[model samples]
Target: MAYDIPPDLAGMNLLEIAEQVQARKLPPVDTWKPESTSDSRMRIAADGTWYHDGSPVTRPAMVRAFASLLWRDPADGQHYLVTPHYRQTIEVEDAAFIATDMRDDDGALAFRLNTDELVIAGPDNPLRAEGDPDAPSIYLAVRHGCEAKLDRSTWMQLAEFALERGGDDLAVTSQGETFSLRPSA
Candidate 1:
């Protein structure tokens, strides 16, 4: 399926993106304490594809809806779909979301997720690089202890953006915080 870039974010600056980001109210999945737990029979593939019963979930809207309810258990480090009633576990091969695109407005970096969620890299939502040093994965902290891994193209874009800033270390500054693209050796 062809995915068109959201028109509003196409040429938006930091301030514009900030305003839109604040306007979005996510579900309070973190606050809920659901006792009942079970397998969701769902899986979020490493490539950011959602699956159920081993079948790909084709609807973007459904994926977005499920994403809104996603939360990570601090005790077991498991991903769950939390509601007021129950907590259903879901398999996450890598990150729950993928940073499909990135935009740099001055020092602030805005990332667009596979679910079309906009997240600005700042103190609240920090960036981290993990995994192998040769091919490290860069992730941005989304909500409810979930993170969005930067896709290959987005990672390349961020690297180029960082390079233009003339940094000795492979790093990028967003919202006054410098994030390293390579894992610490």
Candidate 2:
């Protein structure tokens, strides 16, 4: 799908774009999932180690859970229950990173991230809405990164990428810049 660049993002910086994407005020599409499930549980041991369902959780799972906690929930009283065994695989190729996550129902969540671009595949693909006549996958691409400072165009792009990709292989550059490119799992 093609994105129509918003006039407000014409001359923003990366930081500004990131903030705008975080705030969801950008015109470009921003897509995301729950980032955490509502059926999982966690516990902390006295050693400062964390456990999920009596077992040690992996770093990625922890990150996802933390990230989920940071997301604004649609349901005011509902909370995510992230699974300790929730496994995600990420693969990076050239300018794109492909991430796949397995849901409890055996369904799949796939995400594609590239420099300033994001796309997702799952039960709800927005691309389908554009008359692709197929289940549309969500797609967002950066039009101009260097000029996207306050517009958060990149973050909005990443959000779409994460929503489509399941946030498993989600990658951010050293400068906190997000990209679809990632290393293989």
- Provide TM-scores for the models: 0.93, 0.19
Q: Which predicted model would earn the best TM-score?
A: 1
lDDT tens digits by residue: candidate 2, 1-185? 43444444434444554454356323221133424344335443322234566686557545334323222224442323223423222111111111221111113222222213222322222211111222222232222111001123433453454556575654322233344333222
What's the C-alpha lDDT at position 120 in model 1? 98
Task: For residues 94-167, write the lDDT of model 1, one tens digit per residue.
Answer: 99999988887787999999998899998899999998977889999999889999999888888878778886
Relative to the unseen true structure, what is the C-alpha lDDT of residue 47 in candidate 1, on a scale of 0 to 100?
98
Candidate 1 residue pairs in backbone clash: none
Please report, in order, the local distance difference test score of every candidate based on alpha carbons.
0.90, 0.31
